[model samples]
Target: MTSAPADSVDALIEAEFDKLDLNHDGRLDWADYEILIDRYRKTAGVNEDDRRIQELRAFYQLHWLELLRHSGAAGDSLSRNEFVEATRRTTGDTNRLDAAKVGGHVIFDLVDADGDGSISRDELGRYLQGVWQIDQSDPRYDFDALDTNKDGVISRDEFVTGIQEVLHA
Candidate 1:
């Protein structure tokens, strides 16, 4: 597969950093992660007491720690450049953290509103539109592209693989 150009990848990473820097504070901290986790919880309609929500919290905590560990920053938060570099290392280092697998599982759980094992088109659309505010008109986010088996829904494996591809890319 052809890889994206360095400039394009850097641009994408910068864009992702902007999104994750929720409060526009120019740094990524646990608070940003909490905001993201809360959004996922709201989208899933789960309360803080719910087991799944608790798991999601745990996942984010671990993920945040991993990012910090990889960042090599002196502070608790990561600057934009630090975050971009940390993300690149964390996503590429499967030995230390299988980000795609762990993140994909949690995200899939949140997107599967019906508690089903797979992601339906409607569920994905809702997730894309709600959580990330991604425009549904974007062809790149099409369910058909992710539903490799063409089974009308995206299986856990398919979803994870798609996430892995993006992370690596």
Candidate 2:
């Protein structure tokens, strides 16, 4: 499959970083991650006691640590440029951290609100609306793109593969 251009990849990363930088301080820290976890919790309608919420928190902790470790920044937080570079390296280094696998699983688990091991279009819509805050009216976020098998739901494999493609694209 053809990959996205380097500039496009950078743009994607930047866009993600901007989303994650909750405070708009141009840096990423534990606080930012905590806010992200909270968003997921609220979006999934799971309390902090929920296992899925706990797993999401753990995933964010690990992901944050990995980013900080690879960031090479002097402070505990990562600057915009540091975050972009670290994400590129961390996502690319599957040997150390299979981001698509680990992250995808956690995200899929959270998005699968019915605990049915699959994501229905409605579930995905809730996630997109609550977490990503995407407009439900947008057609570009159609489930068909990720539901490769077209089985009416997004399986774990399909979700993971979609994330992998985006990361590597």
Mark the 10 consecutive residues where model 1 has the least summed lDDT: 1-10
Error in Å for residue 20 of model 1: 1.1
lDDT of 2 by residue, 18-45 (tens): 8888877988899988888888999988
Say which candidate scores most in TM-score.
2
Clashing pairs in model 1? none
TM for every model, in the order presented, reads 0.92, 0.93
Residue 19 displacement (Å), model 2: 0.9
